[model samples]
Target: MAQVEMNRSVQTRPWFRQITPAQWQALLASSLGWMLDAMDVMLYSMVLVYLMSDLHMDKSMGGFLATLTLLSSALGGLIFGILADKFGRTRSLMISIIVYSVFTALCGFSQTVTQLAILRTFLGLGMGGEWVAGAALITESWPAEHRGKAMGIVQGSWAIGYALAAVVSGLLIPLFGWRGVFFFGIVPALVTFLIRKGTKEPEIWEARKNTRSDTEKEGSVIKIFDRKVVRWTILGSALSICAQFGYWGLFTWIPSYLATSVSQGGAGLSIVKQTGWIVIMQVGAWLGYVAFGLLADKIGRKATFILFFGLAAILVPFYGFTHDATRLLLLGPLVAFFGSGYFSGFGAVLAELFPTSIRATGQGFCYNFGRALAATAPFIVGTLAKSMGLGAAFSITAISFGIAAILVILFLPETKGRELT
Candidate 1:
C-alpha cells in the first residue's frame, strides 16, 4: 500500500513543484520579459492602419519600416548574445528592457513616418536583446529533462502579451488614439525592478565565467562558426528563416486584411470585432506554445517541430482562401495553433546545439541573423499585396511553412533532453 501511494504521488506531481525556488524565479523573470517585450513590439502591428492613415504612408513604406526594425533587431541580437555571455543575464536583461521601453513610447510622439521609423529602429535593439538574455537564463537555470517545458512556458507568454496588446488597443485606441497605446509600452520598464529584486544569474554561467580561458572570456562571435558548431548553426539559421518568413508575412497584414471591406477582398471587421477575434486567436497560440514544449519533451524535438510546421503549411492556405466570416473566426485559433506553436522548440534545440561557453552567441546569431534575412518577408508580402491582394499574398506563407518542415526532416537531429554543457 505504501509503494502504491508513492507511485500515485509521483504520477500526480505538478511539474512546477519539481524545480527549485531559484529556477522558478528565472522562469518567472524570463516569462515576464518575453511577454512584455512581445506586447511592446506587437503594438506596432496592432495599430498599423492608424499609423499608415495618419502618417500618409503606403503599404510598401510601412513594410519598409517594419523591415528596418527587424534588421536592427538582428544586430541587437548578435550584440546582446555576446553581452549575455560576458555580463550577467539579469543585468543584460534589465538594460534591454529600458532601451525598448523608452523607444517604444517615443514612437507615439512622432509626427511623421520618418520619426516613427527612427524610434522603432532603436526599439528593435532591446527587442532583440531581451530574447538572448532571457533564453540563456532559462536554459541554464532549468534541468535538461524539464527545459522544454520551461521554455514552452516562457514562449507561451508571448501569446498572452499579444492578447494583452489587443485588449489595450481595443480599450485605449477609442479613448486616447494610437499614441495612448504606444505610451503603455513604458509600463514594461517597471518590470526591471521585479527582475532586479527577484532573479539571480544562473550558477552555470557563473561557473563557466570563473573557469574561462582568455579567448573564451571574450565570447567571440567567431567561435560559433568553429567546425564543431558550424553545421548546426547553418541549419538553425535556415529553420529560423523559414519560420520568421511565414510568421511576419502572414501576421503583419492580418489586421489590415480583416478590417478591409469585402468589396476590397477583406473581412470588413470593425476594429473592436477584429481585436476580439485576435484575442481569441491568441488562446490557440498560448496552447500551441505550451503543448509544443510538452510534446517536444516527450517525443523529441525534431518530430514535434516538424509536426507543427506541417500542419501550419496546410492551415495557412485554408485560412487565407476561406471567405466566410464565421469560418475565418473558427479557423483563426487553429491557424494560430499550428502556425505559432513550434516556437517553443527553438530555444531548446538552439540552446542544446552549443556549449555553455558560446551558447548565447551561437543561438543568438542563428536566430537573429536568420531574422535579418527573413526581414524581407513583410516588404515582399506588402509589395505582392499591391498586385495580388492580401489573401493570395498571405497564402504564400504556406509554402514557407512547408519548407520549414522539410528542412527539419532533412537536417535537424533529435535533441530531446540535451543538457546545456
Candidate 2:
C-alpha cells in the first residue's frame, strides 16, 4: 500500500515526467498502431480525387464509398471490442492490423468502384478494431489522472498518419498513380510482429479476471445495454453520432473540394497543392488532439468539449464560405484544429465510463455505432453539394457540431481524473 501510494505521488508530476518506461512503451505501441491505421484508412480519402477520375465516379458515388467504409468500421469496432474484452487486447490489435493491411493492399487491384468499396469494407474492419484494442490497452495501463493526455498521444498520432498519407499521395498519385498509393498501406502491417513481441494485455484486465466472480469475468456485448449502463451508452452514442457526422461529412469532401475546378464550384487547387494544404491542416489537427488531452485533464472534459465544439461550429462556415486561396490557407488549420481535436476526449471518456470487463465493448459500440449512422453524412453532403455547392454543404455541417456541443453539456458527465479500475 505504501509503494502504491508512492507510485501515485510520482505520477502526479508533469505529465511526461510521470509515465514509467513501460507506460511509454505502451503509449508508443498504441500510437504507432493508430498512426498507421489512420494512414491505411485515410488513404482512400486522400486519393479520392484520383479515384473519381479513374473509376469514373461522381460526388455522390465517391461519398457513398466513404460512408460504406464507416458502416463497415462499425461492425469492425464492435467485433474487435468484444475480442479485446474476451480474448486479449494485444492479440486483437495484431489481428486487426493484419486484416486491414491485407485488404488495403488488395485495394490496389480493384477494377471498379464496387470492387474498391468491397476492399474498403474489409479494411474498415481492421481499421476500426485497432482503435478498440489500442485505446482500451492504453487506457487500462495508464493512471486515470493522465489517461486523457495519454489518449491524446494516441489520437494525435492520427494527424501524423494523415499528413503522411497526404505527402505520399501528393508524390505517389502523380508518379505511379492511385494504385501505387494504396500499396503503401501494406507496410504498416509489418509492425504487428513488433506488437506481438513487445506488448502484453493490460494489468487491469488481467487483475479483473483473477479477482472477479464468474459473472464479472464473463464478457458480453449486450452487457452495456443493462439498466444502469443504458443511459451512458445512449448519450455516448448520440454525441459520437454528431461528431462522426460532422467529421466524415467535412474531411471526406475537403480534399476533393480543394482539387475541383473553380468552374465546377471548387477552390481549384492542383492535386499537389491540395495535398500540401491538407498536410498543413493536419499539423493543426495534431496539436488539437494533444491540446484537447491536456485541456481535458486541466479544465475537465465537459468544458474542453464545449470550447472545441464551439470553435468548430463557428469555423465550419467561415472555412466553407471563403473563396480565395490565401484566405483558405489561413483559415484551414483553425478549422481542422477545432474540428478534429475533440476526438482525443472520446477514447478517454468512453474508457472511463465503463468497467474493465465492458470497457472495450462500450468504447467500440458508442464510437462506432455512431460511426455507422454518421456514415450517411458524406453521402448527404455529396448529394447536397451537387445542388448547394460544396461550400454550402460543408457550411451546413456546423449544425451537427452545434448539436454535439449541446449533447456534451446536457448528457455526458465529465470523467476527468476518475480512476479507471
Candidate 1 stretches with Cα past 4 Å from truth are: 1-13
- Top TM-score prediction, candidate number: 2
- Give TM per candidate: 0.96, 0.97
lDDT of 1 at 335: 91
Q: What lDDT is reached at residue 266 by model 2?
A: 83
- Give the Cα error of residue 100 in candidate 1, in Å: 1.0
Clashing pairs in 2: none
Candidate 1 local lDDT, 1-421, one digit each (tens): 9999986786577877778999999999999999999899889888988988999988888788888888888888888999998888899899888999999999989999878989999999999899888998999999888999999999999999988988888899999999999999999999999999989999999998888877545557888889999998999999999998998888878877887778777788998888988988899999999999999989999899889999999999888877677888999999989899998888889999989888888878988998899888889888887787778888888999999999999989888877778
- Candidate 2 per-residue C-alpha lDDT over 102-181 given as tens digits, one digit per residue, 9 for 90 to 100: 89989999998889999999999998899989999999988888888999889999999988988888889878888999
RMSD in order of candidates: 2.6, 1.6
lDDT of each: 0.89, 0.89
Clashes in each model (backbone N, CA, C under 3 Å)? 0, 0
Score candidate 1 by lDDT: 0.89
